[model samples]
Target: MVSKHTLLSNDLFGDLNPKDWPISLADLPPGSALVGGSVRDGLLNKLSQKPDLDFVIPIEAIKFSKNLSKRINATFIKLDKKRDIARLVINGWTLDFARQVGKNLEDDLLRRDFRINAIALKLSKKPEIFDPIGGMDDLKNKKIVAISEKNLIDDPLRILRGFRLMCELDFELEKKTQIFLKNNVDKLSNVAPERIKMEILKIAHSNWNSSVWPTYLELQLLKKWNEDKLPNLELKRKDIFSTKPIAGVFLAKLICLLSDEGLSSLKFSKNEIKRCKNLRFWVRKINNLGLDNFSEDERFQLHVDLEEDLPSLILFLNDKYANVWLKRWEDPSDPLFHPSSPLSGHSLQKALEIRSGPFLGELMRHLSKEKAYRRFFTNHEALEVARKWTLENSPFL
Candidate 1:
């Protein structure tokens, strides 16, 4: 609601400092302007150490991107030829250039998904902030406001992206924007699976809270994709963030929310799908039959199966067991936690004169389990146990 337009250049230039960019802005075209996240971040003064930059130009973006890559010695990639979108990678910074979507910069900015993301800075000797949509006002108020409902409907991935921004910036979604998102949640299926998967992980990696969980549930975001009902657990915990290999935390939380069918529909890798499936299987088993009821062999097999991914399961345990298991999992020398056979498969095969087959595989597993549970400590004992087991159970004999 301002009656007339005003030019505000107070601190934006100093905050952004185009002269400090890895690639000088002097090389860009006359009308080239820095837009999107870089502008939004500059306005917030929360720029990353190496911020990604996006630009909109009046003319050929792909050609300009390639020329810039050659000049700056960057890696060039054409993201979309039809749309005249391209990317340049150099010095840990990524720069994307795209053709203007409409007649002018204001039109292009108006076409963006959110007010916070629509602010643009015209790059020049005397740069000025462009706030055709009162985006700066929205940023000041710390709220997410969609440009229009049609924008969200045009690209439903923006629906999830808005929540990710909400988490990253600790901003509240404007009530109307939330309603627009809720209405368009079903259209998310029309978007590409990889794009959806990428946004899902970005949300997982953000600092989410209980409040955001209910919003996601209300939207029924993952309900259609999952084979079963979503996990009802509140995954917020202190140790989850403190644990090493934090990627496992993200993956574990994702699998808890999604099912194998959901993950497959999103085209997750075979290994990831398998790991999540096995983790779900064991989690169900452990929940059904109490952990206290597991036999020694069953416990040994759990460690064996999840030795690499045990960190992912530790959060599911109670405090006492979680602390104990985490301590053991961190210690490489903890025999039961990090199980290994005292004798190698080769040694067992040679000593027992057994060919490499199912029997030999079974012998190695048995020896490894026996060693894991403190049943044997040395190769001599392993050989003795192997000989006795072969005599008693070997099909070849």
Candidate 2:
């Protein structure tokens, strides 16, 4: 077994063996070196199953990547023409190639977001790890330390990315780095919405999000996207940890924190924004009018509206209510939680001689509520209720 000291001293990270690479690195330019997240994760011994490999080449990144793609049968995409950044995708691995940023490797590494991501490993038969910024020590200490505040300011999206790394690695931001991020948090307003949204989603989906999310809110990193200064949200770990971690619940909590305007400005999809609105509306209603005080219609509507996103609301409920709601929701047959009508619109229209219109739509909703509350059991009973409703509402007919 190789010791940690040996792994570092020999510059041979086990998880990054060339044999495991999706395609050969042999054809890369002579000065090509693997850099960024893959190197950092490799040293931490936490490389993901499908690691993203980034390479810095001394020259002709786009041309080299296009040629490499044809040779290896990988899909090549030119990311930036002027900067000569390109990507080659093969199997599940994504390999990014970029023209080295400055005159040499150390200069290129220095411009990266954080020390941990600044380290590079030469793509040679005998790989050499370069740690010009003391990134190895930062990794050993499990800290996210920015190489320089100026580097983060150049690309302000990296400010949020630091917290994302914290969520992914369960690492602490060094005190000075936290201050640096806080000072430059407002600069995120200058970042492209797509980039900001991408980093936010990554932070939300991390397994350790519950650990770092509170800190993220406290720092108000995305305040410009909010309607006002973001509140210091209380994210109780128990609220999330009580049940199995769910990506939907995490995303829901994150988006719901944003204003409708904020969500739109950040380019959240229409469906995503709609869901956030629904969640926000219900969360306010439930908070103002206690759940126990909900009319049967309101309660049924809540389940109907949130059938797909019930777990998102769990973050706001106390333990007992969360568990009770979750238990019922877990059962697919729970009519009150899942809320389906015993009879279809077609079946009702056929049985009741009701035309397809606004009236029919309302009747279907009424029947669904009755079914959800167990007021009617069978299709025949549902039909009977529908007939009574039509007679009472449209006696002339």
Q: On residues 254-313, what C-alpha lDDT tens digit does candidate 1 reach at each position?
A: 776578998899988999888887777777777788789999988988898787778677
RMSD of 1: 3.9
lDDT of 2 by residue, 106-224 (tens): 99999999999988897766677888989988888989999999999988989999988998798999999999999988788998999888887877666553557667667878777
Residue 282 lDDT (model 1): 71
| 199: Cα error in model 1, Å | 1.4
Regions of candidate 2 where Cα sits further than 4 Å from its true position? 1-13, 208-211, 228-234, 237-243
Error of 2 at 198 (Å): 0.6
- Considering every candidate listed, which one attains the maximal TM-score? 2
* TM-score versus the correct structure, for each prediction: 0.86, 0.91
lDDT of each: 0.81, 0.81
